[model samples]
Target: MKNRLLRFYLYFILYLSPALAFAQADVPAGARAAALGNASVTLPDLWSLHNNVAGIANLQQAHFGAYVENRFSMRELTTVALLAAIPTAKYGSYGLSFSRFGDELYSQQHAGLGVAHKLGQFSLGAKLDIWQIAAEGYGSQKAMALSVGGQAEIIPDLYFGAYAYNLNQAKLAAFEDERLPTIMKAGLSYRPYHKLLLVAETEKNIDYNATFKAGIEYQLLQNKFILRTGFQSLTNRATFGAGFIARHLLVDYAFGSTTLLGTSHHLSVSYLFSRRQAS
Candidate 1:
């Protein structure tokens, strides 16, 4: 088992190297749309598992969510995520999350298990991701990756975060090398009041260009409905989304336009399980 794991890691590193080496190549324009434009990453639900693992650590309850993104001129992307957190006397709190990303033609699934420990005024966390990819005409492959992230309270209502993904790569198939994309991201979030959140994030990928995202979330109707909007520079697009929460369930939808293509839409649903009664 040890040897097999080692070999898998090796292959993963090999496959990913090419993409990094040729990082300058113009990546498929459509793929970029599928990536940064994903609204699920910013939503305050199970979908946050893949958007920012650190967000899941802050969740007050266990939640599960599924999302589907329809990208113009490309295959559909589907994702499902689960998040859970528990507080402990000795460890502060710990969180677990899992997510999958795939399309009809080719699919990639990522299962992540994570833990967060609060240190002083900051929270630190790490995630281990099990990755599997399947191609319609080719055999399936599996690999492993690791990520570390942290969130710090800069002030009473301001927070800062940083995360690194795919620090290590594992081999998944013979003669077919696939290396995970290494990414570094930093963001600042501010809660001016109880009902509003403003966020701005910048991300850098070893294999692609950098992008900036800014979003705002507002609550209405005594916190029963939420509205969100954001703009991304790399894709030169604006996104508008809304969410409805009733009891322990939340449903969200986002709409945006792509410069190179047409419009795109995303839908997500989440169920939250709280030990204590929800407010």
Candidate 2:
């Protein structure tokens, strides 16, 4: 009977859900970004590969991370991702990331290879992504998506970023006819002092209205601990998150509230293979 119900649910989404919307790619993977209301498009973290592929091109060290988010207490809707980024001496930085959503009954996944190069104060990056959708007894579909992004420092402590996803308007589902949503994003990050950072972003998806977001991060305890908070206009959600960075380890958690979807919790852990030196 459980299998029967699961099959029925799959059929329902296969036919009806596309009319609603689809963005397995938009699920937030970085907990710090979630805490900041999915405003990480311009943040300087390797995990930003999930939000904006170019955001991590400037990272100086090799980093690996894993994270998960549970939405409204539904395990099937939970999102999980693993990411890694390495900086090469001459070729710029390279990143590999994979993200999955849903359960055995239905699922979506993305595997991507990304590269970024820094030219003076400006950084340019691009990601090539393979997207897949699968459902039990219904087979699967695969397609490729492309994204390009760039970021630059307007001054010593202020930065701007922009990226576009699904430039080809890729389609998903082997049997069903559906197209991946193309999205565009732009944002800014400002540092008023050594320990405080502020961010604002705007994102537009082809199928929906534009979203506006803002976030702030503050470093404490000599950069050992961090506090973060942010807000989003799309869902009227507010988020808060905190982080603990000790030597080579990183731990992060985020919580956000919304009206219809209730609340979401995100957690992530990362390690820096070559920890940054103290300033």
Candidate 3:
């Protein structure tokens, strides 16, 4: 059974390798960068739903967030996420989160459920994913995937993390014969002061493209307000953006401009609920 599962995974990877290559051919240029740049790093509140999953595991309280973005004035994207962390009697700490991503035009939906367990200085996490794509006049397909991640404390105030997404190599549909892209990401975060943090991440896809992102955050008004800024690079395009946080609410906005796409804008908002012990 294990060998059979392994063979299936290998075949899935082989089949999806070309899809990533095809996706790289057109090079959307600044689509992802414009939307995700300069967002939060740790519990970034609003953009965390799409930026990184490990960030959600660091939350001290239960949190829920919803966001919407307009892409190039052509499509609308929306997301909702819920996250919680609770102390356990023998397991140290446990974290859970669920997120959904959807677009209007093509009716693409991506949903994920994640769990993490903290052990001393190390943390492990895994995610189950469901993806679907459908259109008004076309057939719709769905797939199942998995993602695994880990985070470790490298120093007193610094941490490192790595994650592999879409590890299952699941097919989008039985008839479509296309596979979802697989991606790997690694990042580091540091806190220089009590209320300031710096983060950087590098990601690579099977499609042969690499991305580098960096951001910083500062707290103000006794932790009631926060400000953030960052930059990222994809191919030859550059993106920058900022965010604001007030108490349990957060708002983020980013802009990307390239010789190809001209200029694009993205905005997201989220709210964190009060901390509660898990039942």
TM values, all candidates: 0.75, 0.91, 0.72
Query: Candidate 2 lDDT, tens digit per residue, 100-139?
Result: 8888877888899999888988888899988887877878
Give me candidate 3's TM-score against the actual structure.
Answer: 0.72
Q: Positional deviation of 103 in candidate 1, in angstroms?
A: 4.9
Error of 1 at 240 (Å): 0.8
Candidate 3, residues 77-195, lDDT tens digits: the string is: 33344444443444433444444433332345555666666667776666676766554445677777787777778889888877776787777655555676777778887889989
lDDT of 1 at 262: 72
* Candidate achieving the largest TM-score: 2
Q: Is candidate 2 or candidate 3 better by TM-score?
A: 2
What's the true lDDT of residue 129 in model 1? 74
Question: How would you encode candidate 1's per-residue C-alpha lDDT over 1-279 as one tens digit per residue?
Answer: 995675455445533575522221111111112333432222333444455555555656655655555645334333444445554555444555554444444556656676766666677777787777765567677777787777778889888878777777455555645455677777777889999988778777766788887778789999998888877787798877887889987777877776775777766666777654333
Residue 261: error of model 1 in Å? 2.4
